[model samples]
Target: MNYFKQILRFAKPYRIYAILNIISNIFYALFGTLAMVSLFPMLNVLFGKTDKVKIKPEWNGLLKVREYSEAYLNYYVTQKADQGNDDVLIFMVALVISMFFLKNIFSYLAMYFITFLRNGVLKDIRNELYKKTVDLPLSFFSEKRKGDTIARISTDVLEIQHSFLSILELIVREPLMILFTICAMLLISVKLTVFVFIFIPISGFLISLIGKRLKKHSDKVQKEQGFFLSIVEETLGGLKVIKGFNAEKIFNRKFKESTSRFYNYSNTLLNRQNLASPTSEFLGITVIAILLWYGGQMVLVEKSLDPGLFIVYMGLAYNILTPAKAISKASYGVKRGNAAAERVLEILNTSSPLQDKPDAQEKRDFNTDITLENISFKYEDEYVLDDFSLRVPKGSAIALVGQSGSGKSTIANLVTRFYDVNKGSIKIDNTDIRDLTKESLRGLMGLVTQDSILFNDSIKNNLLIGDEHATEEEIIDALKVANAWEFVKDLPKGIETNIGDSGNKLSGGQKQRLSIARAVLKNPPIMILDEATSALDTESERLVQSALENMMKNRTSIVIAHRLSTIQNSDLIVVMQKGKIIEKGRHEELIAKNGAYQRLVTLQSFD
Candidate 1:
């Protein structure tokens, strides 16, 4: 119920539609009661128990509205009988038939109005969930599964729609009908209505006690749902690896375990939730049976009740049970939905770790050096960089050469602010990056990593992501500079040819080159190339290095290279080991000095 109140805020924007639905529900409930009450006249006429009526019937104000209604109905029947229609029983049957028709007509209208509110809320909720997902920081995904997130957005949210909307009739319309019917019953006989009131709360309490564990079980079921979805996503995404490793049996066992857990948890949740409907219904029938035994005695033996009026009261009492059972089922649904709502709200309420600073402004251009001032970083508990410092003067080239784990990539990540440093500052020009807007800081630089990052799009569209306004000529020229235009031109669709996922349609070197073309198209003042030519055949490496050299010209470049040959002609080379720089100089200078850089060069030369 608390979660429902929370969800209602989303309905605020569509209050007009909700109000319209409420109005229709009033009419729907009113007509529904009239339909049931209309059946009383049919029973009275059929059983030959209708009372003789007199004209000029009395009205005792609103307190006797029911008496006034009955008197008006008697007048209409007499008038019809006098007009030579003379079929009193037929007129009563027509009245009963009309009420049923009106009930169904207004019921449709009520549902139609509610549909607008229901779907409107659905669209708004999904849109908000998706927007929050995109705005969330990358760090938040570290401990989350993509499939589980997908499930939350798609399946779990849809479940909420079903649980909430399907029971909306019970919440608003049916309850109103029950209330009006109960009032009518009290008007007929307060004593029987008192019994009805006592029966309701006792049944509700007993039913709710049985459903006490519903939310706990539902939460467990939802969690297992996420776990099983994760396993399915993992299995499909890694099918190639699984087959290559011949671990099909192992994966099958793991999947079976996940589903087995899911099966048990779901059974528990369903079992508990299912009990609410039948248990409430049974209690309702028990009360009705007792009421029948008591009311029948009053009607037949005591002769204190009219047959027509007693029939209507019985109909109203039966109507109350329908709503009571529905509400009981809805209560269990709300509990289950609460667990789902919490899962969804968990995402909606998460604050992004990376956010625009209050004073953020877009920088139009880069005019000075990019500086790393004693930057140190640790991802979680493991320190990857310690007191590392470097400066790339504007329009100058500096390359990093080091063993693995020497923080070369860390430096690149820091310069781009993919992560903020734990200690010290990285500055673009003279302004500390922390003081600059994140978008403005990253906008000035372009990056090309060892693995090419490409989407499943045409080659032209992929390049155009760097500069959406780039012309075809600009794209072709960038591709030419990247040494990718030759292969692209030979394709049937040329730049329009699709690259498939992560550029899987292309060779590794070709994909890397397309990535270079994208960076070239961006034409940022600073470029970071992290081992750009490391994963290539000799011929491919030669072509890509040529493209790299061309792209590096006149730009502030930071290159992290594993192959000594790639950085031999670099403007400056720094050798690093164990999170610290051990040597720094020109390639020749470092070789002549016979230090760490010299050792690296000699070791790679033999290979």
Candidate 2:
């Protein structure tokens, strides 16, 4: 419920709709009761049981207003009949019709007012969920499925809109309808009204019993939905791998298992939710049955109640059933919405462990060097970088090379502060990296990673991420330096062509060149190239390696590579084994030392 109230804060901008809705619903409830109450006088005059009034009724105290109003209406009917209008019965019928028409108009207005608020809250909540998802650190998603996150933002948000907003309407209009109906009943006969409510508590207890487990079942259903959606997400992302390995059947079976569980949970929850309507209606009929018997005694056996008024009381009594059923269904809706609200708030309330300190200063320069002093880091129980240290002075390039799992990549992760060190410090220009704002720190460095992370957007838009307002000449210059402009200019749309997902439409070398072009466009002071040309064909490698060399000119560069050829010309080369540095020197010095660096070059020569 606290989470639900937090969601409601998004509705603050749309509170005017709520106010107008409430005003319309007040009139809606008013006319809804009076529409039925208007039937009594018509029935009285039709049966010729009218008490002829000889004088006009005087103003009476507020407590006696009902009696005084009835007397005045009786006097009006008598006067109209004595004046030979002969349309007294027709007037009563017209009055009842007009009351119903106004009741429906107000009902329509009430719904019309709330429509925008409902959709507005939904849009704001989805926008907020997406904003928070992006703000969270990458490590937070390491333990969460992408599909489950998508389900939270899409499916769960829609569920909240339906259940909460619908129940919000129930909380207002339905109860007021019930309140107004009961008030009319009491004016007719307080005794009959008091007796009618005796069985309401029992009916309410039964309805509450039906919904006791709805929230638990709804939570189970939502979990199953997320699991199935995750399967779909993984399947689409790995379709090529699955087909290459002839593992389609295995993935199909897993998806089927997930969906089978989803089917079972959905049926159980919806069936339970579906039971609320009929059960409440049946129970309501039982209450009306009991009210008819009790109220019949006052009219038939006791003769204290007017036959006409007693029939109108029965109409009002049956009227309570509709709102009662609506309330019962809305109660179930609230239970389901609570489950979805819990999921959405779990993401929104999470605090990122990586945030810049309030006093953190922007780093605008890389004047001297980057220093890693006795740094230790871990991804799990094992240390990935233990007691490791390195430095790259301004205008120099340092290369890290080792066998896989030797923590070469972990150095890049730590240097960029993607993951903070568990111990010691990484400093830029004599300032601890943690003391610098993350945005400004990253702004000073450019990264080219193993995977080509391009969106399914036009090439021009993709390049614009490097500089949102880059002129056409700067974009062409960056592409030419990265060796990407040759093929781009030959394409059907040149740089305006749309690249497929993750640059699938382009060759491996082309994608790498585009990635490098983006970094070149940024033109940061420090460049980190992590195996930028390792996955390409020989021809592609030659083209991309040339681009990388052009991009690294006169900048501080940290290169992590498996290919010995790529790092041979680096100013300083460090050979690592099992998270410890074993060899560090110029390329020729390491080869002369006959250490791990020599063995690695010897092994790569055979490949």
Candidate 3:
């Protein structure tokens, strides 16, 4: 119920729809009860029990209002009976039909207005969930599955719609329908109504016992659904590897296992949910059976109740059963909804560790050098970069040459502020990167990673990500600078051609060149190339290296180099081993020293 209340806040914007639905449901409940109560007059007319009164009944005070209303209705019917019994019967039938007609019309109106409120909340919740997912830190996703996030946005939200949204209708319509029906029953006979109340608590207690563990089972089913979805996501992503290794059966078996558990959990959850309707119906029938016996004694033995009115009382009692069944079903739905809301709120309530300070200033341009002073950082407990420091002067290419796990990429991540340092500060000019808005700080730098990340969009559209307002001439110029225009011009649609998923339609070197072209279009003051040419063949690497050299011409660049031959002309080459710098000098000076950088050069030359 707490989780359900949290989700209800999303309904605030659609409160007008909710208010309209409530008004409609109120009328629907009023007319629905009146439709059944109208049976009392029709039964009296059918039984030839119409009263004959020549004089009008006087108005009574509120305490005797029910008796006065009956006296007035009897006098009115007696006047109508002067036409004929057949005409009076027709009139009574017309009254019942009109009551039912109005009831159904308002019922339709209630559903119509509720549709807007329900779907509006659904849309707003999904939109907010997506925005939160995007705003969360990259580190937050490290321990979570992508498909699990997808499940929260897709299936869990739908579950909330089906379950929690139904509560809105049930809250106003069902209870009011029951309340009106019960009031009419009390007007007929208070003793029988009180007798009906005793059994209601017993039945409600029994029905609630079935749903106590419903949320627990529902949570398992939702989690298993997320698990199987992850397996499918993983299989699609690694389809080529699976085929190359001939491990199709491994993934197939894993998928089947996940689905098998989902099957079991769903069966348990649905069977419990299915039990609610029938159990409530049987309990309601049992109550109805008891009422018939007790009310029969009042009419037959005590002579305290009228037969025609008892018949109307039975119809009103039957009306209560439908709404009672609905309420019981909705109770089960609420339990199921609680599980989904918890999963959804878990994402929405998560506060990102990388929030910008309220007073943080925007730093739009790079002036002096970028500085990392005594920075100690860790992904987990052990420090990946301990007391690491570096300075990059404007318009100079500083190359980092290191073994695989030597923190070269860590330095790149820190400079970009993807993760903040544990013990030190990274600054642009003199302002700490943390004190600058992340967007403005990132705006000054361009990143090209080991993998060429592009979307399944046109070459032009992918480049537009760098600068949305870039002109066609600027795009062509940027492409020419990155050496990508040569191949792009030869394509079927040139820059407008669609690149397949992650730009898989293009070759490795072509993709890297497009990446470089994107960076060139942005034309940031600082460019960080992390092993940009390492994944290409010899000919491809040569072309990409030329593009890299051209792009880094006057930009302040940090190059995390893999093939040492490419960085020979760099202004400064820093050699690192196990997160610490071992050598720093020009390519010629490092070669003269015969140190670690020279050893790395020798090793690459041997390769």
Best by TM-score: 3
lDDT of 2 by residue, 49-124 (tens): 8889989999879778778878988998898788654588778889999999999999999999899899999999
Q: Which residue segments of model 1 deviate by more than 4 Å? A: 48-54, 84-90, 165-169
TM-score of each: 0.93, 0.97, 0.98
Candidate 1 lDDT for residue 38: 84
Question: Model 3, range 370-488, lDDT digits (tens) per residue?
Answer: 88899988999888888888899999999999999889999998898888899989989989999988899889999998899999999999999899999999999999999999999
TM-score of 2: 0.97
Quick one: RMSD of model 1? 2.3
* Better structure of 1 and 3 per TM-score: 3
* lDDT ranking, best first: 3, 2, 1
Model 2, 415: alpha-carbon shift in Å?
Answer: 2.5
> Which candidate should be chosen as best, given lDDT against the real structure?
3
Clashing pairs in 3: none
As for lDDT, the candidate ahead, 1 or 3, is 3
Candidate 1 lDDT at 213 equals: 89
CA deviation > 4 Å runs, candidate 3: none
